[model samples]
Target: MFKNIKNDLPASVVVFFVALPLCLGIALASGAPLFSGLIAGIIGGIVVGGLSGSKIGVSGPAAGLAAIVLTAIGALGGFENFLVAVVLGGIIQLIFGFLKAGIIGYYFPSSVIKGMLTGIGIIIILKQIPHFFGYDPDPEGDWAFFQVDGENTFSEILNTVNNISPGATLVAVMGLSILLLWDKVLSKKGKIFQLIQGPLVAVAVGIIFFVLTQNSSYLSISSDHLVSVPIPEDTASFFGQFSLPNFAAITNPDVWVTAFTIALVASLETLLCVEATDKLDPEKNVTPTNRELLAQGTGNIISGLIGGLPITQVIVRSSANIQSGGKSKLSTIFHGFLLLVSVILIPKLLNMIPLSVLAAILFIVGYKLAKPALFVQMYKLGWKQFVPFAVTVFGIIFTDLLVGICLGLVVGVFIILLKSYQNSHFLHMEDVSNGKHKIKMTLAEEVTFFNKGAILKELDSLPRDTYLEINLLKTRYLDPDIIEILDNFSVKAKERNIDIQLLSKRGVIENPSSFTEFFRTRPKSKLSLS
Candidate 1:
């Protein structure tokens, strides 16, 4: 890790700039003490980073859990009680890691995973727009369609436009321009350009703008436009900040419920981050999902103990890390150190940097997640992959993240079943034997209940008085329901005076009287088509 410190240090600095405001924003959203987010960020960087198998993935208090955290804190009656749940949630996740439940992450379709990243990117952009303009009614990191404060996401945007702060807007525009120039122009310059990141440049411009606007009467910028890191009056006050859980509340069933909720949701988000980060890795290194769960679990437990928000493998910070050229865990560790050092040495300076500048930073992060090119690329992969991917995207955008994913998963399964039905048995006319019309029915491999409709249609479509051969040799597994359908078809065949031959592991027999009964008489091992 020390070997790449030169490269990683710069990357860490970029990630630190990005992570700082988000730490505060997410803490505000979680309804925990403002410093809790910082604690989680520190733990995510230091603890999770140190233990994690992932080289580039960053862990932090995720926006995805803000709603749950807010509700849990309320239901548990206090932040301290919620802390207990967070710790318990971590222990549960650790158990999950030991159980090897992380394998589930690998099963998600690549198209859906890509869509998730793209969808999140789009959401990040939409969410940061208000902040960019200095309208921050919701916390800086909230990313839901409906905010915890009862405002619809789109409605909040309209409200922000109407109530836009001119000073904040000016700072935001300036910061954005600086960031754009640094990336689009300066980055192309020479060794010096590569040494300084866009976020750092934008931040410096933000600080200078703050100084220039010190006289609020003359300038559009005001104190409200500035970044607001929680200020502790003294060292003693900072130490007094930590909250202890109400052990009495731990007995409440609701506490346990909240714990399970955080455990499940946090685990899911971590798995998603692991998947998304692997895609962003230039080396194409795979992250160990189970180990990631363990790392997250340990981080969350430590965070809760220290009165911090729950931690997860958060994509926002991780993506920022990747975009900034982070190569290893050193960047993550350094960013954590930065969090600790910033609060101790430069809390006042942090408070002076405008919120709009941080919003500009998030705006870039969001753009990277939801770029339009991602949509076009996914569509080009074909409908089988695209439909589910689109569904997940819309589901997340229109509804909530989990709901959208469930909807997409359901639609994806439905399509798979439809395809199976289409590929299953069908009727075909064979050459007439001595003018006696002959028909053939071919079964698909691994026939299941999903294929019953197609099989029935083919069976019913046979011409009356035609000789039919029902072939089951190719089928690997036969559904009992399908066997019943064949039984009924055989009875109907006799009534229609249709001649039929049955082909299976059993000797080829002509006009079997009872399809189900005949199958029962055959040896069970021999009858299994596979």
Candidate 2:
């Protein structure tokens, strides 16, 4: 892990910047103490990161869980009671780990996964546009469509146009220019640029701009548009932020229900993030999903004990880590330490950084995730894949992450069934024999119930005085339902004056009375093509 400290350090710095606002914003959204988000970030970074099998994934309080946490806190009576559910949730996740439930992530269709990545990218871009123009209406990191703020997503952008801050916008533009320059030109110039990342410089510039223009009437940035960390009066006050769970609440049935909900949702988000993160990883390393669940469980248990919000693997930070050249878990662990040390030692300094500058940084992250080229590429894969990908993208944009993914998955399954129905059998016309229509029908390999409609339709459409050949040579497995269809077809053949010939490696049968016996004699459930 230490082998790439040089790389990890810069990457960690970027992740630290990225994770900081998110921690505060998610807490604000969840209606938990501002400090609780920081606690979750610390634990997610150090404890979860230390144990996770992923090299590039970063764990923290997720915006996705903000609403759940908000409701759970209320439903459980208080934040203390909610903490009990969080701990129990962690335990349930551990149970999931032992049961190897991480495999659930693999079941999501590829098109859906890709759509998720692109959808998140689009959301990030859309959400940050207002902040980019210095229109900070609500706290940062609210990824939900309906925000605690009175406005929804698109309305916020319109609001930004009317309320753009000249000073903040200028600084954001400068910050963005610096990042693009560093990425395209300066970073390629030498090792120094690589050692010090563009985002770090942009943040520093933002801070300097904030400090220098404090007294200027026209160009001043205010506290409302800056990173907000809880300012403690002293060391004693700093430690006061930590809250212990109300273990007595465990007896409440609602607490148990909340716990199970958190466990299931958190695990699913983690698994999905794990898949997304691995795809973003430049090395293409596959994370051990089961191990990730165990690690997350442990992190949640610790977080709840200390009053932190629930945690999960977050794709935004993970993607930032990978894009910033993170090579190992060191970047993840180091960023946690940054959160710990900075919140304790230099929170005042951190608060000086402008949200506009951070928005500029996220602009880059978002653009990379939802590039226009990806749309064209997905379309080229054809409608079967493109429809799900497009639906997932739009779904996430319109709805939340989970709903979008579910919609995409449903569409993917429907497409699969439709394709199966169409490709189940191929009908070909051979030369007519004795003025009767001679048709050959070939079955596809691995026929299942999905294929029954197509097979039945072809068999039923046969004309009277037709000579038909059923070819089973290419079929590896036949469904019992399909066999029933063929059997009934055989009975109907005599009334229609249709002649039947069955062709397989088992040998040709002319006008076989029963399709069942002919198939059962050859193999069990599978046809013996060899």
lDDT values for all models: 0.83, 0.92
For each candidate in turn, give its C-alpha RMSD to the true structure in angstroms: 2.8, 2.2
Residue-level lDDT tens digits of model 2 in 1-530? 89999999999999999999999999998999999999999999999999999999999999888889999888889999999999999999999999999999999988899999999999999999988888865877688777786678898888887898988999999999999999999999999999999999999999999999999998998788899999899988988999999999889999999999999989999999999888887789999999999999999999999999999999999999999999999999999999999999999999999899999999999989999999999999999999999999999888888889899999999999999999998899978879898999999988999998888888888889999988888899999999989899999999999999888877787898998898777744543344
Top candidate (lDDT): 2
Identify the runs in model 1 with alpha carbons over 4 angstroms from their true place: 218-220, 504-509, 513-530
Question: What would you estimate as the lDDT of candidate 2?
Answer: 0.92
Q: For candidate 2, what is the total of clashing residue pairs?
A: 0
- Score residue 484 of candidate 1 by CA lDDT: 91
